[model samples]
Target: MTALFVDDRYRGAHGIGRYAREVLGRLDVPWRDLGLDGTPYAPLDAFRRVPGPGAADVVYSPGYGALLRAPRQVLTVHDLIQLQTAWPGRAKFLAYYNGPVRRVVRRAGVVLTVSETSAEAIRAWLRDDSVRVVNAGNGCSAAFTPDGPREAASDPYVLFVGNTRAHKNLDVVLRAAAVAPGIRVRTVVPAAEAAEVRRLAAARGVAERVEVTTGVDDARLAELYRGAVATVMPSLLEGFGLPALESVASGTPVIHWSGCRAVAEIVAGRGWAVSDAHDAHEWAAAMTEAARSSRTVAAPSDAYDWDRTARVVSETLSDVLG
Candidate 1:
């Protein structure tokens, strides 16, 4: 086991965690767990989590999480959404990305990303036209199959699977709730984020129209996807849109922001409707059409799958470590 796979993000319910969990179990590389206690954005964590001299031949990370001083490492940088979008800690995020995060990516032996859209953003961030950004794409997990126990709700709803990040464009959904009185919004967020989502729903005066939930496992999430008329991924930017892929996998269509090529890249022409996320009426109309849409359960035909992704990571690591 010459490669150390960071596993702390495995506990996450978001795309990063799901990527870590899926790829970690499928990688053919000789590797073992190397958990970092805190977030990779925390400067001090890099110091504490840095592997000592000769700890391993190389290290691999599934997401943007990184070690500042890992001599030889391979990591997935995901997206530069935080840098590209306006957020609460914009200045601090800039410092972290420019400081340690930039160095990590610049120094890494290999950089893997989920989509070409993210790869382009990462290349722009590096400011090096020659920098190679490997796009491994993203896979829809097995649990998100079209055949599943569907969630039954009192009101027909559209699904939103994400945290309350500013870039997530929750405003569109909230606005749609007001514009389209017939459409209900059901959001599934991490447990810690439930309160904030609830608060956002309340503050927007759509608390009754938007139902917030937490700690939904993959099976239940699949059910939710299968039940919803469609999934709404209103994110302004993303490394990759996992929810859209998952939703389409479960035989449901998706309403996504036309601006998000990341989501469009994976879904291809399948089960997707493009609309301007900034326009509430557009979202409302899309949601209305989705509520009236129906589809049959079919296996995902896309080439992206976890096994292939892990194989790509393994090959990249082998090439770097050799």
Candidate 2:
């Protein structure tokens, strides 16, 4: 049976893009791209916008999007962050997830996720035990290791690997930077959000201390990880904490919010978990402690691998197609 994989997700630098690139490159089975590059969640245009996967026995999307009209399709629902958070578009997100997303999962061949934490949440949302929700997990790239070229910096700095999104919880880190005087913060945001992040840092009075960097490739990102005092995973929610996982793999410790279960699950013993997500004082204390502490170190990670992830995905595809 022939398979068609959604290649549009390979464009970005986020977790979904990484998943798409890694798994698609590693898969042993024969497949072709469906050439789809449009928004998959548009309720009205989904059927019209997405091209049909012609002559393909199976269709797959690496992100949390469904080929609503396809006969046999697979999806990777990273997380329901939109539904869980109380943002300005909460009602719209709630309607979308419950309406379009619910119908897709119920009909999908198999639903894949990044962590057990996310899998549990997805299953709970479904309420039906019949659907197959699998935790294919995530992997650390070979670039992020203990022994690597370290990024040079004048003072001790902690790394934050997300944008200014609300769920990314970047505000909490900005708040902590205000009180954590000894430690500098380096926030890596996308080019589109660079100016906004800088403005936010200035508003937070950490403009001098908080460095905003953009367009950091993996090699430079690994260097940044290796030299950091600690990597901060301050996300309010995540399907899988890829940044934290990569940080620990590089021998750098992490300071993550305790509510970030996806992060805490991987970096628990390898770093510190700040219990309060809202308390900036608590985050500041952890940042200060992490800047001074040497309780953690790097290792060539063995727990998660992209090869294994691809194998599971490949197997699932083969099983479902047959």
Q: TM-score, each model?
A: 0.91, 0.93
Q: Cα RMSD (Å) between model 1 and the true structure?
A: 2.3
For residues 153-252, write the lDDT of model 1, one tens digit per residue: 8778999999888889888788888888888899999889888988888887888888888888889899999899888898888888889889878888
Best by TM-score: 2
For this target, which candidate reaches the highest lDDT against the unseen true structure?
Answer: 2
Q: Which clashing pairs does model 1 show?
A: none
lDDT (10s digit) by residue, model 2, range 14-131: 7777788888888777777777655555556335434556545667778766556666677788888878777677888877778766777787646888789989999998887888
Distance from true location, Cα of 45 in model 2, Å: 5.0
**TM-score, candidate number 2:** 0.93
* C-alpha lDDT score of every prediction, in listed order: 0.77, 0.80
